[model samples]
Structures are given as C-alpha cells and as structure tokens.
Target: MSKKKKAKDIMPLLKDEPITEKHIGILEENLQKVPGAGKKGIEKALETLRKLKGAKKDETVNWQTYRNEELKFEFKYPKELDKQFISVVSESWPSWPPKMTIGIDATETDFMCEENPNYKDESGYGERERVKINNAIYCVTSTSGAAAGTKYVNYTYLTIKNSKFITLTFVLSYPNCSNFGEDNKLKKCEAEQKAFDPNKLADQILSTFKFISQ
Candidate 1:
C-alpha cells in the first residue's frame, strides 16, 4: 500500500505557482502553525507571497532632519521616534555644557541603564569598535546595566569633526526577565532572546547621520 501524501509534502510542488485567493486563504489558516509564527506571521507570509509574485517593493521611510546652524551639523532620524534636542549638563553644574544631545525615547523598555554602575564613566564597559559612515570613522562602544529595577542598554558613537568632539548616543530599555540571571543582566535574559530586536533599526537611523559643512 502507498503512503498518503501530507499537506507539507504537496506544498513544495506549488512553490512557483501563481498565488490565488484560495491559496492565500489556505496559507492564512495554517500560518499560525508555522514555526516562530506570532501576531505578525500571517502578514509577513502574505507580504512574502506578494513579493514572490513581483509586487512593487516598498522602500519608503519617513524621516526628519535635525540641523544646528551654529554648530554646522545635521542628521536624519525616523519620524516615529519621540525625540528631542537638548544640552547635557554635568552632574554638579546647572548650566548647559558645550555638547548637544539628540535624545530619542525608544520606549520599548522601562529599565533605565544610564545610572547603572557599568556606564558611569566616559569609557563604557563594552569593547570599542570602529564604524565607518559617510566617509567618517567613528569609535562605537555599548554597555548595559540596571537601576531602580529597570534595565537599559546604550550605544555611543564618538568622533572628532572639524576640531570638535562629537558624540551620538542611543539608549533603549527592556523588561527585566527573572528567568535568566540573579542580577537580571541582558547576557542571561531569556526575554531578550524572544524580544523584537531593535538594533538594526538603530543602525538604519545612524546611517543617515551626517555633519554638514558650513
């Protein structure tokens, strides 16, 4: 007796076939069963199918430019972020320092890593890596820590442009998962494993940064 064919066995045969409404309906029904299929799984599957059928690629991104006329610099950031431009002051000083900060509230996590002991000094905990963007080389360092029951991670890019030191800092917060480590650090956090990764999005925003010449 011949073995009955399974739906999985027949799926490969339709790989190159044109997608129809009926086909989409069947896929949608089974989408939840796919490995790693979560809330957006079906939508992503449909998008993939559309792309396979030669749908137009959507490369649109909404971005806003920030400029400082006196400083002679500018950069672009995603419009979706809750952002602000402000001057950072020293702990003891009330006056604004010479440096300007483009603060972005990622809002994904509630943990504030800024106050963590690991990031208390100028040079952070992580190893510095060199990154080249727009013909400029930047030294990047990242660190993560917890404060007041909140966990946070930060990346700082530093470079000298036109005889002035420039720094761009990116900070994000994540839930403290008790399932990982006693200290609840990111290295052992299982929540970080399943969480939506935002590092790529941060990189995309950083790529748009430029120092405009006066």
Candidate 2:
C-alpha cells in the first residue's frame, strides 16, 4: 500500500496569529539593507508599516481637515466576517494632520464638516448599508470623490453577519458625485489617488483580523 500524505505534511502553511512587532522590525531591517535606505527612507517605511497595522485595529482613527481635501478608507475587525463595525472617514490626503472620523455603524456614518459653515450647502454626505451571510459578513462601501472647495463628501458602506459573528466595512468614497449638471461639472470629479480600492481594501482589512470576546 502507498503511504498517504497527512495534513501535517503541508509545508509552509500559514498561521492565524496576529502580526508581531518583531515582524515589522525585521521588515525595517530589510529596507535598511536596500541601497540608499537612509533615516528618512526607514522612517517612511516604518510609517507605512504603522498605517498598514493600524488599519486592522477596531478603534477609530482621529484625523484633521485641510483647506479643501477629502479622503476615505475602511476599518475592519479581527476574525472572518466576525462581529465588528467598519469605519470610513473623510479628510485631507498627505494631510499635515489627518481629518478622520469613525462610525462603528456604517449605516449611520456621517459626513464631515467643511471649513466654512456657509459651505455646508456645498459639502458632501456619507452612507453605509449592511447584509448578512453564513458565518461571515460581506460588505461594500463608496470611497474617494470630493467637491471642490468643500469639506464634506458623500460616502456609502455595507455590513454583513454570519451566525454569532458580524463584520462591518465603511467605504469612505466610492461612486463619487453621481449627481452633476454641466454647471456642477466643476464640483464633481473622479476619485483621488492613495485611496484604497473597495474590494482590495476589504481583503487587506480582513487579513489582519481575529475574533475578540466582548
């Protein structure tokens, strides 16, 4: 009889453990090994790692606003479509200080305030919706489209739940500025760069998740 390969025979299988500081530190070291990886380069690399790791957390990201800029991204939880809320906030990109906010519930997420109170008419709104699936939540959200010279931007989001676990995703900016006339053409524009893709962001956001007891 021929011997069969057991599951244990699988080499290089992945684990569900959370990312450790050690892993990030090793990555930093590798970056330094690259040519011309100076202090600034290392710092930028570390910052990128921090952002990537930070996105996986369940806490809200407090951000700052700018003259006329808007940004949106998703915040996911630990575990596969587990019980969690997604947050998508709008703010300036490459922002001196990030203008960010968090909504544990996407359906109720709000639009950001503009610099000028009078600009409210020109400001935008954010939206979120949810659905359920077996043992996992599949969500979708809008991201990245801002009205010129306005602080507020429209947003849409989705959430899903599976059994005892639920997962929520807040898409800050997708399907931007649908309502536009020839005059408002200047007000409506395509999505900005640096904003994470809704679907790709979903995967990346969920990749760093784990279930935590309430």
TM of each candidate vs. truth:
0.40, 0.25
Local accuracy by lDDT, each model: 0.50, 0.36
The residue-by-residue lDDT of candidate 2 on 58-123, one tens digit each, is 322332212222313323332222111222442343221222233353332332222222222223
Q: How close is candidate 2 to the true structure, as a TM-score?
A: 0.25
Write down the RMSD of candidate 2 (Cα, Å). Answer: 17.9
Candidate 2, superposed: residue stretches over 4 Å from native: 1-145, 149-167, 171-196
Candidate 1 lDDT by residue in tens digits, 29-148: 766564542425455566666666566322225565667887567766554433121112223332111223443333323212223333444423544556556465555666765665
Best by TM-score: 1
Residue-pair clashes per prediction, in order, are: 3, 25
Deviation in Å, model 1, residue 207 alpha carbon: 2.1
